[model samples]
Target: MTPQDSAGRGLFITFEGIDGSGKSTQARLLAEALRGLGRDVVLTREPGGSPGAEEIRALVLEGDPDRWSAETEILLFTAARRDHLERTIAPALDRGQVVICDRFADSTRMYQGLSRGDLRGLVDQLHDLMIARDPDLTVLIDMDPDTGLGRALSRNGHEERFEEFGPDLQRKMRAGFLALAREFPARFRVVDGNRAIELVAAEVREIVLDALT
Candidate 1:
């Protein structure tokens, strides 16, 4: 358990998955559902939740696929996360509001940590030395890599640098995420993303509701 939980601070919930896994949509739906139940919810996303992080988001997410080396990217992500934690997540939790984040350090773990090389240890070291916290709950939206890649590419969005890696990376990321869930089973709840949107949303709502209780 985190210090926040033991101290009666609010819950920190994060969604994780390969690109285009519908995790973002699920995050929005879950936030809306929780608010409907009269809960105080602070819906946010990583690499851009706070103003400073948003700048970092552009740097890391846009430009060439090799815009920066994995090592450099890890440092940049950590910096943004630190700013986000101090300015946004920490205060909201202290005020006892549910902070629903679209993604967190887990993304960094898969992307910069495992993607280009085996740097999970370095990512964890920085996280432990700096952030030193984890979400109270993490929802992993699992789906086939090719389907996810196709869906993500269809968006034609500007922040498509990572998606540019194509289906191979997506497959690896999907496996990495599932492995991460197994590694932290206590804080993880995997949900299938291949189902209908409404069905997925309903399951997400139920999972979060149970956590809230």
Candidate 2:
């Protein structure tokens, strides 16, 4: 079967951002908006969707961050994503539903690939090995990592491994995300995350509607 056939009817869309980018907020809003349009939308995330993945997520985020090497961290994310795709994402898409994920492959490219080292090639390799299909659209909520991290610290009240990354690492991660966006301009859409939530939500809604159409 062809790639389209492999992808089936489900539209895979992912939201990517640093700690305080409001990615979860926007992703949820997008899912709700799509559901309002009477479409079946499955909301999922990497490193924590499925039961197994949720366990992995805790280990990766809450456990000893220094214990795991960058490659190990990247592989863990890939493993979690592979499970999420096999059990949740791909199936939902095949059934003609809309899948809105909080984060996906690009997160690896940014957090692990860039911050840890030049793992760009490895990110692509993971995509080839784990993800059978590219997302229909990817929305990158671009934000200043410091601002985002500050927001996270203020609102969420704590920082995770990725969130605690230094300013230099965060900058590299941000640059990596932009590069990833450039790699798939047609499928990649960037939304300024510094705006008011309502305004960002509105922009995301427009992009999703346009993409679906």
Candidate 3:
């Protein structure tokens, strides 16, 4: 469905950054902050937000790095996103709740476009064809690749397929995300994520609150 087709009364916010940039944490914190203000908040993530999407998440994140080709991976991610939008995000937005997603199409665009190949046009086309609505605001947690990769590696999980691509790719992804922020300035809020968690969260909270106001 297109953006105009899925019009809702709620706010949609998404966090975008390379892995270990603390986007997930920040997303959570922002949700908590909003909820504290008595707003209905739906905290979610991509690759898996709805039940079907979660299952697809495992298929994409658990397999070997080369298990799926770039094109195939994009398809899987898009499918998961479609399910997420249908079963989870759309309903929450229709309820007028604030929906904060950890990662969204931007991740797909950067990961598939940079790490895999120059398939950015394909990503855009697929997104426009399948899922076209962007978040009302996208918080981009910007940080150095080395620090982000180190933090990502420190975490324990089977969802390491993307992380296995290593630091060089992370650097490229970082650059890609920043470029996207510039490309869509009205919807992008670039936050410095290299500071302590409290500092980053405070800045992110302020930005989001301002948007709501």
RMSD of each: 3.3, 4.0, 4.4
TM-score of the candidate numbered 3? 0.95
- Per-residue lDDT of candidate 2, residues 105-191 (tens digit): 888877787777888789879879877567889999999888887777677532276666656666777777888889889889999
Show model 3 residue runs off by greater than 4 Å.
1-8
**Clashing residue pairs found in predicted model 3:** none
Best model number under lDDT:
1
- Writing each residue's lDDT as its tens digit, candidate 1 over 1-213 gives 432233345889999999999999999999888777767889999888999999999999999999899999999999999999999999999988999999999999999999989999999999999999999999999999999999999999999999999888999999999999999999999999999999999998888777766
lDDT scores for all predictions?
0.92, 0.81, 0.90
Report the alpha-carbon TM-score of model 1 versus the true structure.
0.95
Report the candidate with higher TM-score, 1 versus 3: 1
Which of 1 and 2 is ahead in TM-score? 1
| Candidate 2 similarity to native, TM-score | 0.91
Which prediction has the highest TM-score against the true structure?
1
Please give the distance, in angstroms, between residue 164's alpha carbon in candidate 1 and its true position after superposition.
0.4
Cα lDDT for residue 11, model 1?
88
Q: By descending TM-score, how would the candidates be arranged?
A: 1, 3, 2
